[model samples]
Target chain A: MRVALDILIWVLFAFVIIGAIPVAAGAYQFLLIPFHSFKNHYSKARPHLPRVAVLLPAWNEGAVIGNSIERLVKLSYPAGRLRIYVVDDASTDDTPDVVLGKAAKYPGMVFHLRRQKGGEGKAHTLNHGITHLLADDWMEALLIMDADVIYREDSLRRMTSHLGDPKVGAVTAYIAEGSADPNYLTRFIAFEYVAAQKASRRAQNVLGALACLAGGAQLHSRENLLAIGGRIDTSSLAEDTFTTFNTQLGGRKVVFEPHAVVLAEEPGSIGALWKQRLRWARGNVQLTQRFHKVWFRPSKVHRLGSISFGLFWFTTFLLPVAMILSSIGLIGLYFLERELASTVFRVSWFLSACTYVFLTLYTIFLDGPTGRRSWREALLFPGIISLLVMIMAFAPGSLDHWLPGLFGLQVTEVGQEIWTLSVYAWLSLSMVAAWLVKKVESTRIGRMLSPLLIYFVGYGALLCAITFDSYIKEFQGAAQVWDKTEKTGRVAA
Target chain B: MSGVHRPGVVRAERVTGVSALTGLDQAELSQGEATDRALTDEALWREIAHNRRAELRLVPEALLALLVVAGLIILREVYFR
Candidate 1:
């Protein structure tokens, strides 16, 4: 009982430490931004708006690029001042043909460029555009955008206004769901976007630890970008994170301008949304590993301000541990020691409830006064999904093998390939366990939680096996890459 | 580098020696130059060689890092104790 009590107190202390980080994060919404907003007002005392380049990277956007370009071109900036560069990454469709057609319509307004045929993907395309195409002196401000995104006409002006302050490296405008009538999956994700952008992005900005600017539509200076590195890490799957980290590494502040808004379309169907989010999660996992060196050993300039990037994804792997602890707290409450169990149960519930509330409120706060989210709606997000959504998002896909293969090799193989013989053993036990545990909550839930213990920790162990076994591989030292999600939802009338 | 405006009426800005790709004078390369140059199919692009190391650009991302460290320190001091 004495040893158990000691362990119990230690566990509670761990929970408090874990919960406090985000609570400190939440303090940003209530306290930091308002203060920073005022500081921004003061910085405006001497303004210097550089000529801005709205760089929208697109491939096969024939249907939407026209409108997206027109909307951006018509932005309130001086007529020719706001230039639009759309990198056509070797699309098989009439993307280049369509772009040529638009270039005729908006003669000097829209600039059309193409990537080398075999050398495709956003990072390579961006690197090619920035280095070979543009003379560094001229490309002052750059806006990174997906092909399907649309933006307010005044968006450029507001973003440029902030650039006048030399300290601001990158500015991310508010990204909202372009289609309200999107599928249910899209709707839930849309709310999540608003919450994420407002609460998490806002909190991150306050803490000065912004990991990446949104890829949809964000503005940065060319000179400043080149100073750190021209086009962010082209090798990493997550170019957005690479840019965000580099921007912070440059010691330039990244800001979220709520007033500056853009409408970006997201995947509408379940299959499509899964692909989209999986790419995001996997890309996050990949980038976290790639930039772990920078994040873990951040230079003096951006020590704490930069950790949130790694922290966000790194902590995700810990969610399962936290949930298991919660389960333990409940089990202890039920059978162990009534008083001690009550304490553990109440304490766990309180810490978790507080985290849930604060995270929800921070997101709702980003909704501004007219946000669609209510206190209740935000409260039951994960619970209402009944953990199915959690499994869908977290469960490692069979497709992870394809990811490393995309760079041209299967050498650094993990789990599936590495544990082939071990897998046979585990497979037999898993099948038996599945048959026995059908009535218990869910098998998918088990898959979700099981991988947390495995994902980074297990993936790492498997990679070590590959190296030790001298596994034959492809793409020797090339960066492992993943596919960008195709946005299927179209703008409906 | 994907957003490209459709090629409408190709209007060269009646200049002597500008890029024939767009033919527009003072056509900043960031928009057309980068896109137009990326037309090659087999060029092996090198990642930015690390010749430059945070050479004190206008805004230092380092200050942001320092701010983060300072913030962490403050958090630990205030709460961990």
Candidate 2:
């Protein structure tokens, strides 16, 4: 029995180590960002502006469609070579009117295509445009974009230039959250994008295994699109990811153009953000199953199956599971061996603290303007409670001393033991806190308290909670409903 | 045409018997010349230079971050123990 318990303790420690892998992977990804200059495909890129067709899929986007079209028309590409096609997904609003008006105004540059039967999904709408564009020989490249996003003047030119390299199939731009008057939620999202899109995608470029193209700012060469069946994948919720994987699997390179900036209006509330990310999380779950054979199975065709890429993918996919398992391991160890549990907790969290500091600083340096604006959000990404836990890990017993001293109290042995156990349990408790943040957001005082709850629980924890929910929904075979995030024209020109 | 005027090049023709052109004409000429300058060899080289400089700047910062992390770990090991 003693030997068995010892073996179980060692197994628990292994789970703690497993949880640290994703944190280490995140830091590693950021460390790879500077090397992008050497490994990127820019050497093969040139200023090649093909006859480009911009596909905007709109479903009742009247509020933003007109402004979006105006911005597309004013893009710095040659006026003759660029065209806009807005696929109206049977919008009940004045979307068709706005689009038709723009079509009339821009004449040859803008055209409106309507679907008599709509509400199927974004993929179906995008396919409708793809079919129409492919029917003609005029378009040499296709730019897939959301209706609410505003492209910078030189963005299209920068993106299309990569098509100059015949081997490059697709290009994705840096998508910045562009809510003009961003609240707390948008700021958090903005900082998250700086990390996810700007910093992480740069690392992906170096690895030569892009996980997914930005759904709102993907540009594809016509030949490459036709090679991948000429239409978007309508079966999965993650059509963009499917297309990205298919493009790479077909023996072509997908490049991330950091200079090409697209501004998108992200969700402004917790409920809204939850819905948006839940869809994404579910899609990721679907994709993981769909491409089960591709992971960790190296192929001559693509690097999607490479060990490094697979680690990055699975680490992110299984992060919530890892967090729960780590907590369980620590708690189990505590019952068997208290000293060992304490040491393991300190070591794991110490690694997490290092990752937290390195990634926050590196992300800030990656984009100065966004770094300046969302620095607060960046700092509090792991949540205030997690931050305290990190501090406690860094300086063992310091929090016990300082926190009690602040309240003019002494720490008893029992209280200290309980506190230690609480810290061990916090790994999973943070996810619970995150779910409570969503619950609070739906309450009468949601608008007032939810943001505060988020700061206390942390945005990263919130995302993990959403991913956990996705795992449940997928396991239970929930119906895949296309929940479109309502867009307000908050993006600045 | 043989010496100065190439197929894709535009040369000044001593307008108003003066070698120097007016500001408006120069501006117009620069606008036409801009197309040639777009994404030229010099521009691509400039982009490469910028990337190199960015990489150089980042290396020191990344190194400093590494040192900080190492310092924290060392401090915990030495002081806490």
Candidate 3:
């Protein structure tokens, strides 16, 4: 019995160390973001503007189609040079009529094509548009975009300018959340987008290999598109990611043009966000399967095969699982021995908090108003998620109740009580930190309290719980459904 | 916020040597130049930022801060008692 207990403790310790590896690496990467931003060099020059075809894929997008079409037609790019092709995927709504109306306004420039039998998917709609556009040899570049996304006037020009360099195969603009009436969820997403686009994408640009290009604003050169066989892939829910990899695989450089900004409406509710992110999570898993060779034998040819890109994707997929296991293991370890567990958990949590603080600061500094105004979203970053997971973790009827029986682990009554209390205590502390950060600001006491608040939130362990749930759903061969983020035509210009 | 013009026509002022790819294998042709430029630029920036440790300069600082803070937390939890 003694030997078994000792062995179990050692295994738990090993799990904690193994789990800390990815979290530490992620922290280091976050630390690298600010310096990368500082090194950003911009040069102003008149770029060669190529004849571009914009492929706007629509399906029941009546709410935003008119605005999107108008925005595209009024783009700063020359009317004769920039052609808008809206492929309406058999929408029962007035999307077709809206596109046709716009097409009439911009005669010969904006054209609308409707599929008789539609609703296959966005990827199919894009492919339908791509096929028709490829027939016209005059188009030097093609912009694959959605019907709901509104691009800034110079966005198309900035994206097209990258094509001036022949080495550039594709360029993607940053997609900012344009929710007119901001809710907590949308605000959090807005902050997340800043971190993702500003920090992560910039770091990727510096590395010369991007993890994935933004779906809304991808500009592909005609030649490179042809090299990849001229159709948007329909094999994965993440067709944009598929296309991004294909461009790199076809020996062309994909660039992230940050200056080109596009505003998109994101899901505003938790349920909606969950559905949307689940599709993305599942698509990533599918991407891993589809591009297994990229991992098995990484080479220069497949840029996705490169170390930075590959590790980033792999770690992102596995971190949640690792985190969940480690968290549970630590809780269990704490029940057996308090001092041993406290040191490990505190250290890991502290490192994660550092990463979180650095990311929030850099993301806020990079983007202006949205970052500053929505800064409170950072406090709730993982705090809310952590609270949810803690409730789930300790719920009487949930998975925790079955743990002892399922794992055949010996837990004294006192140990179990202590473990539950400790978890709740940690969660309460995190909530308090979040509350302080959200309520207190710019005061002397606020400044003093800020670091501890930042420390308490750490990498919201609840995010890991969410990811783990997604992982299980994907692993169970859950149906791959495109849960579209419902758009309300409420975007801030 | 710019003026619209004709398609496929490059204006005199806008036209530059880097306007478009001249070769059929434009993708491969431009790879060497872009890669070399990016690599050299990255190196220079790294050296200027912090010689030999530019990219990871913050790691040590963050790690140290984390350690010191975590040490205090652990001391409060365990050693203080």
For every model shown, what is its TM-score relative to the native structure? 0.63, 0.92, 0.75
Pairs that collide, model 3: none
**How many residue pairs clash in all the candidates, one count each?**
49, 0, 0
lDDT-wise, the better of 2 and 3 is 2
Residue A425, candidate 2: Cα error in Å is 1.1
Residue B8 lDDT in candidate 2: 11
Q: Highest TM-score: which candidate?
A: 2
Which TM-score value belongs to model 1? 0.63
Q: What local lDDT score does residue A473 receive in model 3, on the 0 to 100 scale?
A: 81
lDDT of 2 by residue, B1-81 (tens): 011112111211224433221121233224234432443344444554454455456566677777777888888888875
TM for candidate 2 is 0.92
lDDT string, candidate 3, A212-305, tens digits: 8788899988888899899988977788888988888777888876767899998764446656776777777788788787773566665667
Indicate the DockQ of the complex predicted as candidate 3.
0.07
Compose the digit string of candidate 1's lDDT tens values, residues A25-91. 4333333433333333223311223445666666667767777777776565444345677788877
* lDDT, ranked from best to worst: 2, 3, 1
Q: Where in model 2 is the C-alpha error above 4 Å?
A: B1-56, B71-81
> How many Å off is the CA of A57 in candidate 2?
0.1
User: In candidate 3 chain A, where is summed lDDT lowest over 10 consecutive residues?
Assistant: A37-46
Q: Which runs of model 1 end up more than 4 angstroms from their true locations? A: A1-48, A293-300, A303-317, A328-339, A358-362, A368-370, A373-379, A385-481, A488-493, B1-81
At residue A84, give the lDDT of candidate 3.
91
> Tens digit of lDDT per residue, candidate 2, span A1-493?
9898779988998988888889889887888977875777767765465668999999999999999999988776556567899999999999999999999998988999999999889999999999999897778789999999999977887787677778889999999999988999999999999889888888888888999999999999888999999999999889999999999999999999888899999999888888889989999999999999999999998889999899889899999999998999999889888888888888889889999988888888778899899999999999999999998888887786789999999888899889878888887999998898898787788778988888988999999999999999999989888899999899988
Judging by lDDT against the true structure, name the best candidate: 2
